[model samples]
Structure formats: C-alpha cells, structure tokens
Target: MDDKDLELLRILEENSRLSAQEIGSMTNLIPAEVEARIHALEESRIIRKYTTVINWEKAGNGEVSAIIELKVSPERDFGYDRIAERLSRFRQVRTLRLITGTYDLQLMVSGKNVQEVSRFVSEHVAPMDRIRETATHIVMKSYKENGNTLFEQQEAERLPYSF
Candidate 1:
C-alpha cells in the first residue's frame, strides 16, 4: 500500500459516504484514480466493508452486548485458527480476536438481553471440544463505541421543566 492508498483509506475511514470526487479533492487525485484505488483495496481485502455505528440506546433497541473471554486447548496443527473459524460462524458474535494474555481469545457478543447472551455461551460456546473455560462480562453502559461518543456524562443537557 502506497501513501496514496493510505490517504484514501484514512478519508474513507472517517466517512465512507464520501464520493470518489470528494476523496480525490482531499488527496489531489482524480475521481477516476480514487475509484480505481478503492476498487483495488476491496479486491485485495484491505477495505473489508463499509459499516454504520449506531447508538442502540438512543434508537431504543434495548439490545445488550458483552465481552467474553475464552480459554481453549488449541487443536493439533490447526491451532486456535480452527476454533476461531467455528466461533465466527455464529450470528451473535460481533467481534473475536486471538490475544496474547491470560486468556487465549476474547469475544464480543450481542443479544436481546443477559439471558440470551448466557444461553448462547452455555449452549454453543461451552460445548466446543477445545474450549476449556469461558467468562462473560455484561456491559452496563457505553460512553463511547467504535470511536463515536455515545454520551458524555459530564455534559448532561437538561430541559427546563415547569411545575
């Protein structure tokens, strides 16, 4: 990836809705060049997908999210990659990563409520052959997520109420 490619990525990262012309304006490249660069990025799997970060609370979705840590005895040669691939197939799994720490893997899962999350882990995750142990932590509140501030507790805006 060249400097131009990095610049294009940065521009798109801020706001994916920006047109090629808009990005080209910022990077001094022509619209056609910007489009071609973006296409190449997608083909190379560098730019995975364009996504929207929603304030689920403000939207009144009432969905709950949690971070779960897993300890697994990695399979023969396939190792953690095999276990990770199986976990990725589930719809509830939002994010999963293999980390070097006390635990082997950490997962971010979302569901309607705690019960749903518990059920998913107990039913699916716990039963996995390689998985030795699992720990789940439910999110109480989110101040920020995906680089967007959900709420600022310090800057609480109150409406003037008349009795």
Candidate 2:
C-alpha cells in the first residue's frame, strides 16, 4: 500500500525466511511495524503463501509435470470463471492462467508418473463439456523454475597444449 510496505514485499519475495528485525533494518522500520505491516499484507491476501522451490531431480522424487492448453467455449454470463473455478478444485493442477493466446486456458499439472498425469487429462480434463480441445506437453527437464536455476553451470576444462 505504501512505499515501505512495497519495499518489505520485495524483500520478502526474494527470501521469505528473513526475520522481521532483518526486514526492519532494510526498510528502516521498527520490528513491531514490520511485523504489523506483513500481517496486514497477509490478511489482505496480497502476500500469498511462502514456498521453497526444490530441485526434485536431485531429490529423486521423479515427479512428472505437464503444461496443458485448453480451448474452450465460454459460458454465457459467467464466461471462463465458472470453468476455471471447477478446474481449480482438481488436486493435480498446480497453476492455471487465462491469457491472450490461441488457447483460452493453460494449466500446469504434476503427478507421480506419466500414467497418472495422462489419466488425469483423459478422465478429468478432456471430458469436460465446455472444453473443446486439449494439448498436453510433458516436461523432460527443468533448467530453471520460479526465478531459481535448477542446475549449476561450470566453466569448460581445456586440455593441455603441446609446445
């Protein structure tokens, strides 16, 4: 809402683990003020849940992720809101967006394996009445996610040259 609040949000967005005292130091506010502002932000729903991004490959989770594009016929009055709300209830859906593109909606979904994801698409998503078409793309690897790089880049080692 104010400049100090915006500054606090920026700092928290980068690292949510910082203490109110630490945030206060950066924002030039007292710890109590920092805490109160952050609480207000959370109550207003401007600051969503804090999350940690994990490199699941190294964790050995073997999670299968897919990006699904849906072409749909918008309902009369409600437009995409009705369908979007219904789709949001599905546990597999991680992210959903309505964008200016060929498809009306896009969804990010994940499951333990490809079969599970495929079954979700076929049984739950594709059969929906308003959904005209669906395209599912499986993710093979992730180099970066949520502003963090998943892999570390190393300098190439060169062979010794003869005189």
Candidate 1 at 69: error in angstroms? Answer: 0.2
- Candidate 1, residues 48-122: lDDT per residue as tens digits? 999998888889999999999999999899989999999999999999999988889999999999999999999
Error of 1 at 138 (Å): 0.2
Query: Number of the top candidate by lDDT?
Result: 2
Worst 10 residues of 1 by lDDT: 148-157
Instruction: Please give the distance, in angstroms, between residue 146's alpha carbon in candidate 1 and its true position after superposition.
Output: 1.9
lDDT of 2 by residue, 51-81 (tens): 9999999899899999999999999999999
lDDT values for all models: 0.93, 0.95
lDDT of 2: 0.95
